[model samples]
Target: MMFNIELKDVGKSYGDNEVLRDIDFSVDKGSFTAIVGKSGCGKSTLLRVIAKLEETSKGTLTFSGEGSKDPKIRIMFQDDRLIPWKNILSNISIGAVNKAAAKESLQEVGLIDKEKDWPDQLSGGQKQRIALARALASNPDILLFDEPLGALDALTRMEMQNLIEELWQQQQFTSLLVTHDVTEAVTLANRVIVIDKGTIQLDEKIDLPRPRERDEKFTYYEKKILNQILGG
Candidate 1:
């Protein structure tokens, strides 16, 4: 079967500063993949490169199968990135303004009632929910999440994690998440890619079932991933 995303010997640099080197990977259709690494390891940079927000210094990226023309890609970031001037509905719509689609996306994130409220008036969790709704409203073929829950508190982070998992299952969209949280990656991803010093150190299958609990088994896998990332 053909893969949905393919990156062959990809690399990137800023003048003399090389940020990524000879990276390679592929993602199957409907798969959820996570990239984790320490700060400045080029995890987010890889996501940006894949999303075409940043051009690669070398190599090729290929998107296959249906929806390849436009790809309907969406990105959610660490910050909510919502406009303070826009209300929740407008923020979610982002000028698409399909009332039915906006309503459905907001309801999916449990923010349907806050449509009239300004972004500044929502809680951190709600702001993130709006971000999620915005991403979903686009009906993306692939969702690129760059530390989307990094700013939330523990409880909110857990909630958002569950929400993302649920949404992924419901939407069946291919996803690539760039996160520093090992447990979060384990919980949400079917495969985890570990990058270090501008290189991919490990690309391992999670093999864990969906709705994974943070029990001993999950903890073990988390430790193993941490060790791989840290070169332990």
Candidate 2:
């Protein structure tokens, strides 16, 4: 498998606090990989390092394939992070509005009509949709999702999950999602990495096909992943 992102013996620290150590992983091009773990397990910190938002203290990071240097990487945070003063359309475009690209991206997230609306005018789910639209607008090669669905209600979360799965299939970007939801890991990821105590404890692939429904089979797989993360 050709990897778009590679981390070898990576480590990060804040003075005496070692947030991550000796991490190694590779993300295959266009694959959806999820990092799941308890809070304070350094999942977000690890993601920050991958996104280049933070520099690692040790080891090497490499990128291969198209336009590797800046590689069109976009990070979607838990908050929608939309500019309140800007209309949804402007917010999604974020100063780089190509009429065709912005419109198509917004439509993909089901916010085409809401483009003119203000950020405050939309529900939590709608706001998130706009955020995803913004991330997609960049035509990113890699998309880093930092608990982007953490704030939604159960029903909305499910809907957003479906929307994300659809978009991933359509866009085919290498995606790394840092989430605490085990069911979400099972539902959306091609592989799941369990991050614990500043390092990856388990890395398992999901052999299930795409468009996975939360059926009995999914539930069983979810339980197994939950156990692995919980160290059972």
Candidate 3:
């Protein structure tokens, strides 16, 4: 019962289109994992299936842990998905039990000052922070990210990455990120999974120390994953 999530022979399909097949993995509690692959390679589909946003067509998806029969799971996306009409505070408070919890989450993202500001007034990166705050407000046991930083400019993206890593280190929530950027995957995840043609091609453990650099070892793993994805 130590694992937070497990998939056994999982499969997903839309009629004749098979998006994921024979997927098998177990996510350790409080671990960070990244899934990467080319466009249309079903990486996102795997996350969706695990998140129950899309039901699997075959096999079992199990949730187990101490008091995890009905675990709290949250997902963040690249779109930021904020409600334009609501102010920053209210947006993150959507599922929160109280304004205090929402405020704490907002503060965690370093956006407490923007509480009363509308979503339109905030920049793209700020909006995404609010999105992350909203996801964190629920105190999720598992957090899934579907390319949440894809829309940001380079510097902002790196900033968000740092913020995310800091928060993850502090909170120790189980995380799964689906990203097209191998560097992003290598930088954040303790383990990186490469998917091709709807199945996992390489599952590499990133033994590099945290606050990881794009050092030689980092580049080696990055190139290995890239080669796997590109069929090099």
- The models' CA-based lDDT, in order, is 0.89, 0.89, 0.92
| Full ranking by lDDT | 3, 1, 2
Please, what are the lDDT tens digits per residue for candidate 3 over residues 53-130?
A: 889999999888796587778899999999999989999999986889999999999999999999999999999999
lDDT of 2 at 125: 92
TM-score of 2: 0.95
lDDT: worst 10-residue window of model 1: 65-74
| Ranking 1 against 3 by TM-score, winner | 3
Q: Sorted by TM-score, highest first, which candidate order results?
A: 3, 1, 2
For residues 128-149, write the lDDT of model 1, one tens digit per residue: 9999999888778889999999
Which 10-residue window of candidate 2 scores lowest in summed lDDT?
A: 65-74
TM-score of each: 0.96, 0.95, 0.97
- How far in Å is the alpha carbon of 189 misplaced in model 3? 0.3
List candidate 2 segments past 4 Å from native: 1-3, 95-97
